[model samples]
Target: MFLEVKNIVKSFHNEAVVRDLNFSLDAHKTLSILGKSGCGKTTMLKIVAGLENADAGTISLGGKNIDNVKPGKRNVVYLYQEDLLFPHLNIFENIAFGLRIKKFPEKEIVEKVNAMVESLELNGQETKMPHQLSGGQRQRVSFGRAIITSPSLLLLDEPFGSLDAGTRQRMQEFFKSLTAKYQITSLFVTHDLKEAILMGDEIAFMQSGRLKVYKDKTDFINDPVTGVQNEIGFWENLIPGKVERETLRK
Candidate 1:
């Protein structure tokens, strides 16, 4: 296991938000967590990233216990729903910020940043500010920035939730391609079941701070409580045709 979260527990006030959460993720794989709002999904991610303290349990990454590691030194990155690009920096500079902070040699930073921009298809827009790009484009920039650091783990919290349907779909496809290209180990939390299926190698449901990880896609799709099958059924009934059914399957 590349990342092991063992018996993690966190509470707010007097109520437990995450209860003995235990999960392991291999390197270069993705795990998607599905849950409704206030299910503590974000809190779990925050704890894993070392942003929030866990009252109990441990976080191990790369076989070492990182429970006491500082957030910056933990080799983890957290990205939120909004693309938090620096408004003052252009696309190139925004992506290069991490490397600059690390004081990488000038030539190396340029090479790496340019390669990442090219991979993300942002070559011609390197000089644009965050406000100049569309929502999807801004998010691509965000993804590039986080991935350029080559962190040990990436925590994404509903990163595509704010986009329109068409843009959201495109971002989902883009994320798939980026993950394939980078082979990043990511823990993604989203309420959208379709996005969960699209983004994760394995799906897990989070409710009331408890996590139930499905063994595979079949288990996820077949589970009644996940409501994935119900959502699919809704689409199937709404559009009655073999083509529509096949489209839904895809």
Candidate 2:
């Protein structure tokens, strides 16, 4: 495992949200979590990203304990539902922000940002302000910003949820493509079961802050314990017949 989260626990205002949660993700792979809102998914990502402290347990990255690491030192990036691109910066600058903060050479920054922009399909839009881009395009800029830095781990909290259906599907495919290209290890939390199956190499279901992690894609979909069967039925009804085969392929 490249990222190990063991015995993780968290609470808010004395109410337990994540109760002894545990999981791990392999390098260059993704683990998508399916859970409704308020199930403590966001909190778990925050804890792993060093933005929030877990009440118990430990987080280790690349075989080293990062429990005490500061958020900036954790080598992790979190992407939320909102694009959150800098309003003042052009798309290229936004993607180059992290490199500039690290004081990377100007030539290197330009090379990396240009490569990232092209990979994200934002080549012609590099000079455009964040405000000028549509929701999906802005989100692409955000993705470029995070991925251009090559973080060790990327945490995504329903990043495509805000987009319209067509845009959401495109972004999802783009996300899959970029992660594959970058070999990024990510934990993607979402409410959609289809998205979970589409994105995750392994799947986990979170209910009331507890997790039921499956060993593999087949087990994830077949396991009745995770209510995956119900989700499959829903997808079957929604898509007629294609979803079932698509899910099995995933």
Candidate 3:
């Protein structure tokens, strides 16, 4: 396991938010967690990123215990629902921010940022400010900024939740390719069922501060609690004979 979270618990004002969470993720793989709001998904990610302290349990990254490590030293990047780019910075500078924070050599920062911008398909838009870019473009810059530093783990909390349907779909595909290109290990938390299914190499469902990681996609799909069947049923009900057509095709 590249990232191990064991018996993790967190609470606020004596109310438990994450209950005995235990999960492990392999290197260079994405684990998409499907959960609704207030389900402790964001809390779990924050705990893993060391942004919030866990009340109990341990977190290990790359075989080293990081339970006590500071958020900046954890080598984990937590991305929010918003792009959170620096409004004052251009696309290139936004992506270069992390490298600059680490005080990398000027030449190296330029090389790395250039490469990341190309990977993000921003090309000539590097000089443009965040406000000048489309929602998807700004989100791409946000991803590039985080990924440029080569973090050990990336935590994304409903990253595309703000986008329109078309842009969200495009961003999903773009993110998939970006992850593969960077060999990113990420925990993607999304409320969108289809997005969760499409993004994960492994899948899990979170409810009431507890999480259930499925052994495989098939298992996740078959589990009624995940709501995959419900989604299928809804579509089938909307279109008359859709289920019959699927059955006949099979």
Candidate 4:
């Protein structure tokens, strides 16, 4: 397993945000976590990123224990609800910050960063400052920065949550291509079901901090929820289907 999160639990004050949870991901696959707001989706990702320590359990990456690893040492990069890009830095500088911090050769950093900027479609925006770009463009820069470092596991915490629908949809498609291009293992948290199905090789539903893995598209939609399959109608735009409740006649 490239990543393993075992029996993790987190709490603030007296309320537990994440209950005991276990999930693993292999190399080069994307996993999307779907759930409602305040359902601990972001909290769970934070634990894996090493930003917030779990009260219990362990997270391992590539057969090595990472429970006590610092966020920077874990090689886990997180893109949160806001783009944390530095306003003082240009696009290229923002993307190259990680490489510089690691003392990578300038030539190698330029090569990698240029490639990433081009790949993420921020080619001409390299010289632009954060405030000069649109929201979508800033998000692209945020992505470029996270990915340029070649992280062991990429964590996305609602990176597109604030974008307009059209831009968000376009970025979603772009992300599917970009992830494959970089060959990175990614675990993403989103409330958008269509985005989850489109990007993830496997989908996991999270609720109340409990994790449930689905086998495939068929299983994800048709899998029994209580007595009936949990049919999500959010994709009516693409599939054009309606959710019908069929109760047994008495």
| Residue lDDT tens for model 3, 1-250 | 9999999999999999999999999999999999999999999999999888999999999999999999999999999999999999999899999999999999999999999988999999999989999999999999999999999999999999999999999999999999999999999999998899889999999999999999987788778898877777887888866853563242
lDDT (C-alpha) at residue 161 in model 4? 93
Cα lDDT of model 1 by residue, 1-250, tens digit: 9999999999999899999999999999999999999999999999999999999999999999999999999989999999999999999999999999989999999999999999988879999888999999999999999999999999999999999999999999899889888989999999998899889987899999999999987788788889877776787787755533563465
What is the descending lDDT order? 3, 1, 2, 4
User: Clashes in candidate 2: how many?
Assistant: 0
lDDT of 2 by residue, 14-37 (tens): 999999988888899999999999
TM-score of each: 0.95, 0.93, 0.96, 0.89
Question: What are the candidates' C-alpha RMSDs?
Answer: 1.8, 2.0, 2.1, 4.7
Say which prediction, candidate 3 or candidate 4, comes out ahead on lDDT.
3
Candidate 4 contains a number of clashing pairs equal to 0
Residue 14, candidate 2: Cα error in Å is: 1.8
Per-residue CA lDDT of model 4 for 65-148, tens digit only, reads 999999989999988978888999999999999999999999999999999888987888889899999888888889889888
Off-target runs (Cα >4 Å) in candidate 2 are: 234-250
Q: Give candidate 4's error at residue 227 in angstroms.
A: 13
Clashing pairs in model 1?
Answer: none
For residue 78, give model 2's deviation from the true position in Å: 0.5
Q: Please, what is the whole-model Cα lDDT of each candidate in the order they appear? A: 0.92, 0.91, 0.93, 0.84
| Candidate 4 lDDT score relative to the true structure | 0.84
lDDT for model 2 comes to: 0.91
